[model samples]
Target: MAFEHPYGSYNVQGSLNEWFRVNVTGNGIPAWMPSAFIHYDFPETGLISGHSGHAFSLTHQGADPIQQYQGRIVGDGQRGTLMESTLEVNCWLSREKAGGAYTHRLRHMGDMVSYIFQSARDVPLTNVYGSTTDPENVTALIRIKPANEQPVLPDPNPDIVRRRFLIDYRWLERVSAG
Candidate 1:
């Protein structure tokens, strides 16, 4: 996928793997999309790459009621929630940003656009979620509209609001080459 990086000037190339088990909640009731994951290649030479799981299956249930909707929102990075639910977004790794080591924008693609400004840095979980802590776990936040479209950051036009997901990059693992 190739698009302008939200934070820097670079193009994300290559297919993204399935990384980070994300929980979809907070922004909407009965969640529009399911608790899913996304994957990214370690940034190299200003060229980065990644993809949402199952980006091209064409499985979206935007119009259907919440009960009938099934998960699998991943789609091509540009489209509408009426047509496509999830999208493969542009990402970057930052050294100056305090929010996280990496950041990516998850967008609700349509005529009325909205964005989830995700920021994640390395943080070891010791006794946070459970009795056992994983070293690979990293804390991340997906900042939506009110949180994302702030004075200091670039505005994504908050008038058009959409469902957003809060992401946590836990259990860092490589996407298998199989």
Candidate 2:
């Protein structure tokens, strides 16, 4: 079975290697505090590629320092304008009990980005869901159109527009007493 998790996209014009960063925060059964960074590379004639680094810290009601995970993104751009791309993230935790990597695909369109995350391994859980510690591999499809197509006038200093996107995960795992 599969589920859908959607996060909006942004429209900006720059080299593929430009550093992009986002911060995500949320509240629910288990609160989430995660920060993600995307570093795009210069546009190549054939493909536009980038890398992502993520750090997530989760806190629950009764759990101590719920869980923490970190990973990276490996993706390839299918369009000249970086319209669509696929990503794989290698994740790990401090506890070491729950640690794994996930691979996802990310697509960029105009002003919206969608992410689809899948599990790298199979588990007994009824439905596989991403967690702060064990984040499911995610593929995000984002739509982006530049605000202005024309080049800006020459100036000593230029005002650049920066956009950000955030992802939140919530779920609980039953502790096994064996």
lDDT, candidate 2, 1-178, per-residue tens: 5442222111111111111122111111111112232223322232211222222211111212233322211223121211232221212122121113211211121122222222111111221133323333333322222222122233232211122332222222222222
Pairing residues by index, what is the TM-score of model 2?
Answer: 0.18
Per-residue C-alpha lDDT of model 1 across residues 1-178, encoded as one tens digit per residue? 4332221101101111111222122243123223332333332332212232111111111121112112323233321121111222322222222123112222332101122223223222222222122322223221122112212333264321222222212221111222
Cα shift from native, residue 118, model 2 (Å): 16
Per-candidate TM-score against the hidden true structure: 0.19, 0.18
Runs of candidate 1 with Cα error greater than 4 angstroms are 1-30, 42-106, 109-133, 136-178
True-structure lDDT of candidate 1: 0.22
On the 0 to 100 scale, the lDDT of residue 113 in model 2 is 23
What local distance difference test score does each model get? 0.22, 0.22
